[model samples]
Target chain A: MKSKGALQRAIAENAAGYFFLAPWLLGFLALTLYPMIMSLYYSLTQYDMLTEPVWIGMGNYIKMFTGDATYLKSLQVTFAYVFLAVPLKLGFALVVAGIMNQKLKLIGLYRTVYYIPTLLGGSVAIAMLWKRIFSSDGIVNAILRAVFHVNPPAWIASPKYALYTLVILTVWQFGSSMIIFLAGLKQVPDEYYEAASVDGAGKVRQFFSITVPCLTPVILFNLVMQLISAFQAFTQAFIISGGKGGPLDSTMFYTLYLYTKGFYYFEMGYASAMAWVLLAIIAVFTAVIFKTSDSWVTYGSGD
Target chain B: MSTLAKRRLYAALSHAIIIAFGVVMLYPILWLIISSLKPGTVIFSNPGLIPESVSLEHYVKGWAGVGRIHFSVFFINTFIVCAAVVAANIVSCSMAAYAFARLQFAMKALWFGVMMLSIMLPTHVTTIPRYVMFHSLGWVDSYLPLTIPKLLATDAFFVFLLVQFMRGIPKDLDESATLDGCGRVSIFFRVILPLSGPALVTTALFSFLWTWDDFFNQLLYLNTPAKYTIALGLRMFMDASGNSSWGPMLAMSVLSMTPCFLLFFSLQKYFVQGIATTGLKG
Candidate 1:
């Protein structure tokens, strides 16, 4: 009887566990899984939200590759933004982390001060703040005028400089990456540095040989994540361009273009195609990174 | 050179570098605060770090209405949505996490791997089809689309974090609890939930911040301005006027960021641990 009771209890426990996870499982099916499949189907069709989707295999893909000029432009702009922003942001973060890791007085205050921008970085408020600062008559231009006595260009209004404003905004939020780098720096053994000092290694040489090598995995992690995020950036570009992808479409990022196609034009099929193509691009890049990571990434066991 | 003198020089140089970057980092925010205090024309005419005099008129104007749009209603709606999301994430994620961590289940590893894949799939890829699905279900312009997802373990990052923490807990506790004649539910409620406080807090805080800052999803799901969250509401503030009002807009922007700032300070310890572990491991 006891054995039977135990068996029944085990079944009951499994049932309860399933019940607890039901909501998430249901959501995955209805929301995520179904939508993912439907998007694949939509990519082959011509959908305009209002009318039923019309099947047109390979046409949307062809247009994106060949016929669409904005798609190519957005791709190039997004690539430039990703490559420029990710490396520069990570470099700044590493420097800040190194400086803060020193045994300085009021270290906590410095961390807090550095992290403040990250908390506000993605907000509409910051975007508005960016708009004002980069505007023709804003403080930055005012400083330029006072210092050089020359007219400053409208940062956001001018197509040539709009994306750079975004790059600056991204670099300003290096606090998140900086905090991560600080954590990694804490994990480095002090004895290694002590030994390096005995070997008469300068600070720069110690950093290059010991510090950089130890921090490579963390750096790789930061790089991959930042690259993915930069490619998918939408909010900054959207707000700066006034949600129009404007100023000669210079700020038309990949995701913004996808949004415009999907929502603004209601070309759901074409948008779905664009999304899939983007997924393919990101997947290839991510796979390449993962493949190369094995060559350099040192795990805890150094395997 | 004396060692003390060299130390002083280095300290001064470091401080100078930090202070210079600090100004660059903080000047825009300081300017936003001052700009919000200024009147519309003064914001453009006198763009400096500090305002000559502060005025509450912009706050009043932003709070009340920009023409016909009421910012207060949007604020209330955002609060409701965020609160609901926080509550759901805490309850559902903890429960699901307990199972994934302690309970012996078939194909558990496989299921966990699948959950990880969801994290890599850019959410934008799924937005349109999800919109269509919600529209077909008549959930558009409703809170259901936003709130209901949190009840599921759809947030793989939170689930992964919880599972990692759970693994660190000793399994002997589970066996001992079972010897005490406590059933699985009792063990989970009594043994697991109490010990999992920090992990639970971390998950809850992230949910609050992410949902609060979410714009794309909010913009896609919500139709009417009255249903907008703070993120969407702030965007609407920018788009409301044909001509932008920097002063009032910046003021409203500052107000919108307050909750997140307050939450971060109140829960700084958990926030730091959470970001360091999850973000750095990416």
Candidate 2:
């Protein structure tokens, strides 16, 4: 009888909680959960909005791995972008954050200027401006002539350097990471720095031994977030390559390719399969990072 | 040199480096603004700060966009969508967060965990099914596909952020309010929402900015020229044809940057606070 009364209380408490959570619960069921399950089912079928789906298990995956050259190339392009862009962005952010940490005059002006790109970075206008700036007769070439009296290749047009242009664009907007790193720097207890100074450690030495260790968790968080976003980046590539992944498919991000398959080509099953593969790839990378983080990430002992 | 002189020299060196890069960072935006004001002929030829003559031709033409659809229509559409999204996120997310942070419930941990998982899941994974569903619902070719999910509290990040803030609020207020014969919902209104002003403001700001900057989903859902947002309008100017309008295009791009610049400059403190709060003490 006592156990039965406790169960009744549990039900009553949960009913109130669920009432408050109604909107999210209804949304998750209808929007997120249903779509996820349907997408998985679609991945196993041969359907293109025009006809009824025919069950063709593993056919889409097999075609992607063995027959689709563009699939492999998109994977290569995404991985290269993730590896190169993540490090460049993080390193640039850390360096700038380090500089801003120093007590300097007119720091506000410096920060505002530095952070302007990240604010307006994702807009279509900025993407258009990037295309113009890297074109054959653009300002980059103009600057090259003025500074070094040398000629350079048109960046966006050349397949070899097209991805690098995107990478540089990614680094240009490091203000988000820069802000995060600056926050992390502020949280590094000043007492530790003072103690290190008394032990005869120089500024650089103290940064490496004390500051860097304390920042490992922030670094990990930034890394995982940047990696995930980079894999899904579509706007820059779409605008730069004109959504065709052109100039030899050099800038074909995975998501851009997936969109092309689903919407443009109307190959819904193929696109669904590609989407699942991309999800699994990202999940593995994220899982690996989390698994290995315990060795490197320092979140204060005795938790 | 003495140690004092050496330290002074170091300080000067640091300022020089910082200020120099600051110029480098601002150069592209400055070029964009100047190029927008220049005559079309000299825009590419003369890369000077001051144009030979100033003209608002680009702005005039850009404002009169492709066919009969002016840029003003697009701006109004974007504002409507963003306003709806911001309102939905603030209200729905706060309600869900309040329940999670305060009330005990059956399967509470399970629900919270699933919501968190939604944040890390790439939207592309569900895009196809969602498109098919919306198409079947006859909600395609409209703003419903974009704004409806927000109303449902689909974006879990804000919910997670607000929940963290609510957790940090002292529970004594809740206890006292309850002791004073206030119901659970009353406690939430009288005590919790008041304390959550900063976080809600942050949520509103981010939702507005992200919705404005969003391109892919907007492109997918909204098809007609009459319904295009600013991002789509800019793309119309840059349709990759041989005879692209460079001057007008750059002008519109420059104009597009103004809202974000103004907002960031005006409320940068909260922007920084929002970003900083995300990974603090991990």
Candidate 3:
């Protein structure tokens, strides 16, 4: 009798579970699952949103790989961006986190102030402001001329430095990674540091021997997340370059290029193919990071 | 030198470095706030931190907006979309998370995996087909295309977050409530929702900020000027020549950042805690 009652209760609870999961189930089916599968299908066809999809197997992929100079340029630009921005941002974040880990007066206020840029960084207006600041006669060059007697080139206008301005912007908004690092830092026991000091280890030695090892998991976390985000960075380039990866395509982020191909040129199929390749690339990178993380990342529980 | 004196000197050096970085970080925003008050022609000319002669012309003109739609309309549009999303997410996500956390269902493990995978997937891949789906549903120019996803808990980030939060809470309370003959629905509404205050606030905050800052989707769907959100409206100020009402745009940009700044300041503790924990979990 008791077993029957328990079985009935389990059945009822399962029904309730389905009730609560109804919305997500519907969403996963119609929106996420459906769109993801159809995107794969869309990648293989020539559908311009107005015409019935012309089934062309692997043609888009072949064109993209074999003859697409713009694609190659975008790939180069994106790789350069990812390589430069991710490390610089992480390093800056780690440095700041080191400083912030120290107990200081008005630290909360300072943190709030520091995080202000990250919050507003992605907005169109901020990007617009960046464009203005990097203009030839704008505040940046004006300050450079006044302070150092250097006639700075129009940073955003020149192809040589346009993408680097975006890099600077990305590095400046290292607030999130800093917060994560600080959390990891706080978890390091005071006893470990005291023990290191007793053993005559210097601050740098203690940091490497104690703090660095304990924070490796967090370091790995920041690395993977920031890498993925950097790969898909779109708004900065799109807004900065005025939606057309202009002035010799210096700031054409891969996503921006994909956007132009789909929206401006109405080649949705080609864009889908591009998007699919990016997805696969990101997935592979993420998997590699996870696989390698076991060797470096140390957790508190050792799990 | 004494150890105490050495420590004092080191602390001072640290403060100096932090203070310097603080200024560098804040200078752009400060210049923006100052430039918003300066006359248009004097903006680039006056590179000083403060405006020489203050003017409210930018504020006046930016509020007037381009064409017929005022900037206030854009703010209202953003507020409506954000409010609906926040409400929908707090409700739907909590439900989904509660199910994931407290109950066993068919394919529970598989569903969990799918949700996690969705969180990992970059949104760029799904944007096209999702656009096509919405277009076919005649939601091309409407708020439905943007807001409906929130209603369905399509943002697995919040679901995952809330699930982790709920999992942290002990199951003892739910067991007692069940013993009291409280149904799962009652346990959800009467017990769990009340306990998930900080997590819900975090959800509401992120949903509001992300929706407000979202440009691409808003740009894609809402082509008409009247329907533009703050992000889309701000982009409208940028004409083809890379020049627009510079001062007004600055003023409006300052205005655009105000809501986020105010919320962050007032709720600094929750924001910091939420962000710190969210990163560690991921």
Candidate 4:
């Protein structure tokens, strides 16, 4: 009789669980699942938002692969951005995390100061602020003139250096990753370091052997997130290029290009195709990382 | 030198490095604040650590509607949207998290896995379809499109975070409460929520920040200039005529960031604890 009561109680709770999850489940089905399926259908068509979608199976994909010059260029630009920005940002984060982990007075103040940039980084305000700082007569160039006695190039306006300015902007906001790294560092056993020190391991050697190896999983997490975010970067390019992705489209990131096509050109079908293609690219990249994670990522496996 | 002195040396070096990087990180924002105090032309002419002279004129101009774009309206819209989102998220996410974390259920793992998949899908991929659905529902150009989804547990990150926090609380309390004849709803509100204070605050803070900072979705759904968020309003300050108003723009930028900065500092203790623990199980 007691077992029967317990079973009835479990059944009642299960019903309550479904009731509690109804709203989220409804949203997941309506908003996420339905839209996801619709986009997949939209990607194969030639709809311009107003007209009916004319089915052209694989045509959009074909044009994207064979005829589109900008697609390949965007791929290259995105790859370059991910490769350059991720490592530099992660490295800077690690260094700052190391420093912040030290026993120091007013450490909280330092953490707050560094974290301010990350809070402001993704906002339109910071993008506008970046525009000013990298403009022709902006502070960077003025400083260059005063210190180096040479005029610096218009950082955001020049095609050759525009992307680099963004990379620098991204690297400057290394605080979020740095905070995560600091948290991970705290989890590292102090005994390992003490043992290493006893074996005459200096700070540098200890960092390589003890710190880096242990921090690999956290590092991989930050890397994957940063890479995906960088590929979809739109605001900085949009703001700096004055919404044109201009200076000959040198700063035309994939998402920016996709936006221009979809919104500005009203090529909804094409834009949907581009979105799927970008999604596939990101998926493949993420899958590659996951595949290789086991080789380098040591989770709770200390030597 | 002894080991103690050597460790002190290392700590000093670390402090110096962190402080130096902190200054570099803060320089551009400092520049923006200083530039906001200078006159329009003088901004480019003198880019220095300190302003040539302090002025509130730019603040006045920026606060006043610039060419029909009202900053105050944007601030109100953002506040309303963000507040609604926080309220809805807290209520719905807490309920769902309690169910998943404490209750016995079938297909719980499958449902959780579905929520995890939702996080990996790039939002842009679904933008077109969401727009179409919203248009059909007549929610386009309305705050409903921006705010309604939070009523659902659509924010999987917060749901995941709350679940982890809920799991940490001892289940013996639930059993005792059950023995006392309390229902699941009462137990959730009286027992689970009060114990999950830190997690709730963290979720609220992130919801506020994300809603305030969200620009693209706002740009998509909010068509009328009168309905712009502060982020969109700030973008409207940029003149297409190649003659941008640097002073007022910078002033608005600085003003816009103040609330978020204040919110973060006020909740710093909870924020740090929440982030560290969230990463552990999330």
Quote the lDDT for A61 in model 3. 95
The sequence of per-residue lDDT tens digits that candidate 1 reaches over residues B148-214 is 8788767778877887787788888889999999878888888888888898899888888878777
Global CA lDDT computed for model 1 = 0.82
lDDT of each: 0.82, 0.86, 0.87, 0.83
Give the TM-score comparing model 2 with the true structure, all chains together: 0.95
lDDT ranking from best to worst?
Answer: 3, 2, 4, 1
User: Which tens-of-lDDT digit does each residue in A1-303 have in candidate 4?
Assistant: 999999998888898898888777887888888988998899999988777899999888898889988877777776777788889999988877876776688998898888888877888899988888888888888888998999789888898998898888888878778878888998898899889989999888887888888899898888787777777888877888877776767778888888888888888888899999989988998999989999999898643
Docking class of 4: medium
How far off is residue B4 in model 1, in Å? 5.2
**CAPRI class of candidate 3:** medium
> In the order shown, what is each candidate's alpha-carbon RMSD?
2.3, 2.3, 1.8, 2.0
Question: Largest TM-score belongs to which candidate?
Answer: 3
Clashing pairs in 4: none
TM-score of each: 0.95, 0.95, 0.97, 0.96
Worst 10 residues of 2 chain B by lDDT: B39-48
Instruction: Show where candidate 1 strays beyond 4 Å.
Output: A1-13, A300-303, B2-5, B45-47, B242-244, B280-282
C-alpha DockQ for predicted model 4: 0.57
